[model samples]
Target: MSNRPITPLLDKVCCPADLKGLSDDQLKQVAHELRQEVVSAVSETGGHLGAGLGVVELTVALHAVFDTPRDKLIWDVSHQCYPHKILTGRRDRIRTLRQEGGLSGFCKRSESEYDAFGAGHSSTSISAALGYAVARDLGTAPEAGVGDAIAVIGDGSLSAGMAYEALNHAGHLGKRLIVILNDNEMSIAPPVGAMSRYLNRLYAGAPFQEFKSIAKGAIRHLPEPFQEGAKRAKDLVKQVTVGGTLFEELGFSYVGPVDGHDLDQLLAILRTVKTRATGPMLIHAITKKGKGYAPAETAPDCGHGVSKFDVATGVQKKAPANAPSYTKVFAEALIREARADRKVVAVTAAMPDGTGLNLFAERFPERIFDVGIAEQHAVTFSAGLAAGGQKPFCAIYSTFLQRGYDQIVHDVAIQRLPVRFAIDRAGLVGADGATHAGAFDTSFLANLPGMVVMAAADEAELVHMVATAVAHDEGPIAFRYPRGEGVGVELPEKGVPLEIGKGRIIQEGKRVALLSFGTRLKEVREAAQALSAEGIEPTIADARFAKPLDEDLILGLAREHEALITIEEGAIGGFGSHVAQLLAERGVFDHGLRFRSMVLPDTFIDHASAEAMYAEARLNAADIEAKVRDVLSGATAQAARRA
Candidate 1:
């Protein structure tokens, strides 16, 4: 609040309707104010900064030109929707982004009517927009009275196969759809793959740059009957020297490479497109990711994601780290393994920094491969590398790996390819919320045959897991670790691999046993301490491998303890479910051994701090102790009644 910038023009605009009343000159002021507001809001909230700043003029133009809600404007990934949110009557709640009971960081359909589609994952806008277009044509979506469906997508998102698939269908249908390709030459990481290079070449050529005005002038002069054909011919000529030919061939009329920051240009072009007849038109607008603000514009990644920072200095206020991050630990461990093994290589799906592959890339530059925003390709590509006798570690976030699941099952698991999966952010991530939660990887991967799944309890254990992934070339193996820093533990000089299916006991106790699968071991220990203070010393053990089921340790605990509780930081069908199946098959339940599985609740928990989210999920230390008491007390009462 102290750092909020003055936005006199932006203050008057409550909605898109207010924006329509402004003149072109006034709109320019609004755009400038909007950019300032976005920077100020993100400086306070510390969410996605660069993307929103990039699309300020485009947001203003789209709202001004189109009849929203009816027109159905969809933002791909929707991380860049902050500017859109402010203009669409959500300005009052803009400061509360990514906080509990506040506005979501990403778009949510339930949040507002202006939010035409909810999105977290990238490259989905075009597909959803095509659906809207089809629905409008079929008269199935008459409730909102759809007019046009416009998909605003980023350049990096074009790498995904789904986008192309949607484009192909949209073109074939010949429906009135508008796709604004916001080519900022950046995704999370500076883009990778052929598509990025193609986009780069599009704006780089001098001929393509000159063709924009020339083609527009030529098309306007052509006879009304000849205009359509002449425009296609010009597009074909432009495609020969520049990019967008790929999109054109897929069957859409391509326009621009327009300057995104120029409000006059954006407004004129958008207004023209809104009036003209179109069959799947793609407006390729060239933009700088962090356009308006100098601090973000100059910064690497354009301040893609930031913590709360000083506005004048542009220096972020980051919390001091108490321990080594799980990401860094994994990276260093992988570097160690790569030093020993020349055959090892790393792969990431456009998230080198996010997954800690940036550290590995520094060590083994040629060996690291970033496949851009293509997770499916990353998985299958890793499988191919493994097939070629190279140890390929596909370092991907657990939530992102969901996109590559089919490849995991078909290419790696079925073939028993020795691909190592370094699954980062394996539990409920704070701020990013349910859309990004790594809750289902454990459940999905554990069920796959020849797939080995492991989760680290802390930093030191993560090192060992990395080593384990390196040494074990048996099949497709994955090790998951949560986001942020580890639970401060002493580090070993080097990690040594563990036995395939073995688990180690943390503490020995009496009547009740608490079996933990992932980072929840810390909470289990805290719960155990609380129980001990009350004269109940509960046993705790870490089930390192959820897939293999640490049979000896789990069965032994079931046999000796009066009641056993399994806890994991995943969904219902994950580690706990696997443990229960193992116990039931062993006839442990028939002997009246009270068993309970603690997992995340069925509903999706919203954005909040990690501790608060865990509390909401009932997976905190207090909840753990309560569950143990409930199970044990119930068994004690039943025994007394029987006696």
Candidate 2:
């Protein structure tokens, strides 16, 4: 690797405050250098690339125009914060982006003051900025000028209902806020839904610009007395001609469809918007995802997130010969089932490739639906599909599912709709970190009245769960799996449906019982083996159904073993929480039995290698062994004390 000294301009810019001194030309150069820095950093670290690349000039322009830390600039989704990170006191540490103990992959409030508001999920910035703007308005002493709240959001994010909700509210509240719509025509995949279509029409047609030019020409031709009347006529013409009167009707003074990449235009527009705009205003800026990089630009699925790659050739590193990922396994299983059964359909909220449904989309184009970034809509839409005698497998990442919690609870669970949720990335997502971790799915879904929650112990079990979901037509069911490749088990040609609310004993032993949930079975097995070396043969049971808990299997294990440990890849209220509730209800804990729960610690794990994050959370094999040993040793000490 060639070692290069950090440029002096970059090194000097610790914050947006420092950027105020730079000339506009220097700012443009800085934007270019920042993009290069982002490219270099993400090439090494591997993160959200296209979004950041698209926003480099915007980032530079925003910081140059606004008083950032003071002005509370919130980036929607925050995936595009690489350039923001590079500008705000993190230039030297850019290489460590997304690594454990390094700079966060997204904007994190705890990480830096410049972050303003943390975001991982999209459509949150407008709401967050509005909140800040309101707070600033409420906090203003007579002498203090209004603090600015700038929300930089992507066109893809605008598809979500929450974004529109915030826009409506922001407009009604009449807050001093600036919403910068970064129209890149992409989310991870090409954006879908009506909003994306509207943006395309607005930008592609150039009708607004054409109308504005025509009005100006008309004004030049009109006499002085007629000029004033023509201007009012022009306003009426704009209302009919320019489509953004929708925003104006909502109370926001809508601005431009300006070139986001143009440094001078962005700065000039932002400067004018910053000073002149009274209420909420949206400056629509058109941008290209993966602007500088040609390979990413042309790639149909715009280079959103990528693996570590060779920047020169744009070649992604080849995967090692290993088992197919759980996502791929889930996809294959779904495809096999769909081929056999016509009722089986699939849905993904802006994540066909991520959820491994791209294969399904290609094969069964008619059955699959890609609901852009709108998780709530995807859930309710799936409910509609299910009600229409179709088995809609709403395949979503665990974290993204959080956005549709209300829909799942109300539309699916309450009404008892048979919407199969193929929840991928169901545990701690490495590199993307805590915001993307699927740690709450089990806990949240389990509490829903009629919801059936299952966790896959391995790829094979994931296939079984998919079959189980297909077979069950009573209520909402969710099957969760991790982010990476599955264990090297050969996939069965046909998936066999599993018995609902049942668990199987993987290994039978004595003294201690290790109840494993999800893909953490591998670690549990290793920990059990280590315990065996110490003459403690622990029983290992895979609690397949998180909600139902396999009560018979759990009670049997609790009675047979001296101590019980429930392990899951989620937070406190998940599988472990269910197990705890079961044990308490059965009066098993009345004997004062030695019980321990192994759940992800109540902390936001940083971006890092999966192994490293697991190790940090003490969920890795070694850490699992240590925890098991500690619990067993504690049981021994307690026994001695009782005696």
Per-candidate TM vs. native? 0.97, 0.92
Best by lDDT: 1
Q: Looking at candidate 2, what is the lDDT of residue 447?
A: 90
> 224-261, model 1: which lDDT tens digit per residue?
42248326534434543444677778777776667777
Per-candidate total of colliding backbone pairs: 0, 0
Angstrom error of the Cα, residue 323, model 1: value is 0.6
Candidate 2, residues 1-643, lDDT tens digits: the string is 4634345577678888888999999898788778777777778878888888999999999999998677888999999899998888888788888887898888998888788899999999999989888877787522334479899999889889989899999978987788999998888887888887777776455553453444334334323322242133234335335446567767776655667787866776677566656677787777889999887788777678888888887777767858888989999999999999999999998888999999998999999999899999999999999999999999999999998999998889999999999998988888898889988999899998888999999999999999999999989899999988888987787889999899999998988888999889998898888878888788999999988779999999988888898888899988888888999998999876778888999997888888888888888878777777788789889889989
Q: How does candidate 2 score on lDDT?
A: 0.84
Q: Which parts of model 2 are misplaced by more than 4 Å?
A: 1-12, 140-146, 207-243, 318-321, 641-643
TM match of model 2 to true structure: 0.92
